[model samples]
Target: MRFSVPLAALLGAGLSEAQYLISEMSFGYAGRISSADNPGVIPNFVVSGQPTKPEILSSKVILTPVAPGNARGAIWSEQPLKHPNFIVDVDFRASGPDRAGGNFNIWLANHGKDIGAKSVYSAGRFEGLVLVVDSHGGQGGMLRGFLNDGSVDYSQHHSVDQLAFGHCQYSYRNLGRPSQIKMRQTSTSFRVQIDGKTCFETDRVSLPTGYDVGVTASTPDNPDSFEIFKLVVMSDTSSHDASSNSGDNNNNNNNNNNNNNNNNGNSNNGNSNGGSNMLYKKQSSSGDESFVDLADEEADVFQTSKSQFQDLHNRLQGTNHQLSSVYRSVSRHHQMDEQRHNEIKDLLAALQSKVELLDEISSFRQRIVALENEVRNMNNELHKKLQDNERSVQGALRVHHNSLTQRVAESVPGHGKLIAVIIGTQVILVVGYVLYKRRRANSPKKYL
Candidate 1:
């Protein structure tokens, strides 16, 4: 568990963990592909970036579109890398229609056992780097790797979700338009940049080093061309200050921290043997010397994710408010309708009362007319009797007058009673009809 490792091995392993992998295809370095000696050919390439039969002029990588108008290319590493942290960067100039591929044309394949179309990615055996481009703008890029698996030895695979650590504008119009791209890895964070501008940064990425670095390019409708300017690799050693002679103290601290953390993490996995397949530590050690936006990247990622979450929360709140307003408005309208219905019922009652009054007045008028007619008839009978006989005419007149008066009196009372009954009946019928109508209107029945 406490075995010492050579300085060189430690450096290589550490370099894999701390280096920044940058690729700027700007036709620089004699248009030679990064890490490849050939001018146009991309090494470890599953797909060709340039034509198999290329046209090289003045060290420029010229590409001529084939039929159907799409160009595809890829470049992979000759050997696998085994570091736990690192960065990657790539730049390309694209023209015509550019469509993203199933997998990122720009990616880091880690712990990949074989190279071909069909390859099995073992648990904890792979990590991916991605940059997606479309006509709209740059899409978010991602890095993926696994932790544990069941088939190998563990009970289950601790699957990781696709986290958006960084985003860069990868549009067809922006490619090769004087841009610098970079991916940097530190002890506990990852940073990405484009054109010296920080794009993606995250502290959640935990990947092992010794991954095959590769580039794959694809365009769908039209042939896409990329211009690569430079590819540089460097290690991260910012933790150390060469001016200070406290190298001994730094070395001791670095070793102790590295060993302690590794052992503790392993022991928690139910494996008693902590240093058998553990990481090697060395004397006179130093951290990786890779360069990236360390401070800015961490801050940037935190802000971006925070902003996105806030935006979604605001939208939800707005929607709830809108729904609440609609409900309140509907409730108010319903109450108003109920009040109007009540007013209509009161008006109908008043109308029925007035109708009953008019009927009573009509009956009273008819009775008065009948009484007048009886009085006139009695006077005419008395006058006829007086003309027929002179003798006792006054007495006859008196009797006739009395008889008429009594008849008038009797008729008046009878007429009044009859009129009152008829008026009462009509009033009752009218009130009953109005009440029945109001009840029916309030019930759940069709108005028509």
Candidate 2:
């Protein structure tokens, strides 16, 4: 719950002395209120509005409205503001059913528990400042600042109509995300920030003392509500007068300690001085006291200077040794870096060779694909030529067969009669030749 301010930020802003922690409240210390609990009986927080007690679930102070109608509720801190200049950090969640009509307020008011009716808007006569989270109408989720001068009668109605002093829009209702608001208030200035962004700031505002810091919310005819996780109020301790006083106290303490050490050193010196005085008294009887005193003072000065020189020499030798060690370490690191660089270079060369080999393989594959395409084109041409030649030969064979059949039919009027005549002629020729051959054979028997 405690927040720390950055030292650098303070110094850079010339506010090095302005950093201090005043108060922090996590709301976690409060006990959980169950259904059986009474709202009016809760300690440290004054709850008003609705019939049910505001529940503190999971360490969060929840202000949920009662169901069935417009409802409002508020929880006010029992402790009053202790510092006029302070910062307030609040971690809260404001959500409900989508587009719910409601708003949440963080009030720094002179009035304690009865600031208003606690329904959808503030009620009752009040003084001091109010930071309103209005999540309704066209300007939904608007963050507005209101200062009640006790002139307007809040009891007449619950609307914060003409009471707004300044306004800024911020989307927090039903956002399903937690929102943070930081307010830094000084004697002459008032500032408000939402989620680290400055939403409103002005110098025309002032808040009196004895004001209570509290939270309130109102839901109108819906399940709209808000919960506060943590609230921290830090008092600014950087006032000029406080810083001067603190500095003076520190200086006084330092002076006192130094005086004590000086007194101890002077006591030791007194012993030496007493010894010198005894020597002086002895030398005075011999008329040599003044010269002895001068010589003793010179010796003491020389001894002090010698001791300082020796210390300086020892420090220089240590520095030289440290430097030598650092140089050796740096050289070793450099050698290691060189070796790694060489290894990386060799790896890069290997990767380059692999890339070149892949490129060559890709080119060879492309050549093979081209050659295959060429062979396919040649094969297709040869097949087309073979088919043309086969068709021509078939046509020629058919013509020749037809011509021979026509010639035979024309030369022999009837194929069967021609065949029989041809057969009879061949038989007569064969018989005549045989008869002649037999006569010759008989006549040839008389002649050798």
Candidate 3:
């Protein structure tokens, strides 16, 4: 038993460091030996054949293995654990599975108390891992998590028609498995793994702490036979044991005494109204089923409301997504427009440059044409002036020669040479003026 509380003092000392408190501990298993040669510790308790008041039958737990190869068992406890965060390990060996009492091997319940007829609670459910194994046929085992409240958060179950086991095949199931199951009060998450394989995990658990923890088994109409090997429960002690259990025994004795007195009073009233009263009590007991039904109905309403809320939330999210897409599209369009504008600007700049070049070319061509016309006109004018000057020079020379012949007769014949020189000077002046005008007209417009 102490082994089940492994490192309790150490754990207490480490609580502050770990930020958790531990409270109660327990283990469960069926008392059975595989072979007389191999004597092992098995804990079992007897229960009535029928469900009278639905009580629990549990035996003293052994924390250690009985033999060298003896396997372990599963265990659980009522809240509050020693710490807010607690870990429970189950080392169990299951064999000769049968169908009885729903064939549920392991279960956990919280926040519950026994009413006169049936248990009642704000909320409580049996939850655990289901194994799928068949040694007889070749069927394998599966691990499932379920809730007694008809609520399923996580599950692992094999097909019902699957074979259990077959010849030449080892047990097609995970058995004699050692697993560490942990629950932290702060979080509703619980996880289980066998060996190194994850068997089950869930976060939908919302059971309250500081509540009764119990384990139960049933002999089903199917009558399945299975055994729990070992169990270990570690919880927050500071919280789980909020009240001092110092005088719990004394208090229980007192309560029992009071109950006896109440029973006596009930017996005295058991006269003519006894049968009628009993019928009324039965009817009231059936009302317990209605409690479950009411809970189910309320749960249905809550689920419907939740689904509607979720649907609306999803619609809003979709709208937001569409809006975001539209924003991005607009941004892209703006960017493209800017790029096109830049391209147009570049094209305009190039066109302007080409236009300036064309203008310059046109001016150059016009200058060339003007220069050619001016040169032709200057040549014609020069030729005409030359002919006129030649005529004038000839006339002057003839007059002067006649005057010089007269003078020579009277004075000297060399006077005629002077007249010829004057005529040549006039011709040279006219030619120079004509050549200057032609050069001015032929010059480039740029220079002008």
Among all candidates shown, the one with the greatest TM-score: 2
**lDDT over C-alpha atoms for residue 377 of model 1:** 96
Steric clashes per prediction: 33, 3, 49
Give the per-residue lDDT of model 2 (tens digit) for 1-448. 1112543343334332233333322243233332235432445556666756566654566676435446666777787775668877777787667656677788888766767435324456677777877764475668888777777666576565666777777778666777998889887798999999989899988777668878787777766767777666666542332344445455445644654554454346533332222121111221111222212233353245444453344345335544654564465556545654664565556555666777788899999999999999999999999999999999999999999999998887767988899999999999999999998988845555
Candidate 1 residue-wise lDDT, 244-268, digit = tens: 2254456446655765765565456
The runs of at least 3 residues in candidate 2 whose Cα sits more than 4 Å from the true structure, single-residue gaps closed, are 1-43, 65-69, 116-122, 155-159, 238-448
For model 1, the run of ten residues with the poorest summed lDDT? 288-297
Stretches of candidate 1 off by over 4 Å are: 1-67, 82-87, 97-104, 111-126, 136-165, 168-178, 237-448
Local error of candidate 2 at 447, Å? Answer: 55
Instruction: Rank by TM-score, highest first.
Output: 2, 1, 3
lDDT of 3 by residue, 270-385 (tens): 33212211111111221110111111122243244444454344345335544643464465446545654664565556555666777788899999999999999999999999
lDDT of 1 at 284: 36
Worst 10 residues of 2 by lDDT: 280-289
Model 2 TM-score, all chains together: 0.47
TM-scores, one per candidate: 0.36, 0.47, 0.29
Clashes of 1: 33
Estimate candidate 1's alpha-carbon lDDT, on a 0 to 1 scale: 0.46
TM-score of 3: 0.29
Error of 1 at 324 (Å): 81
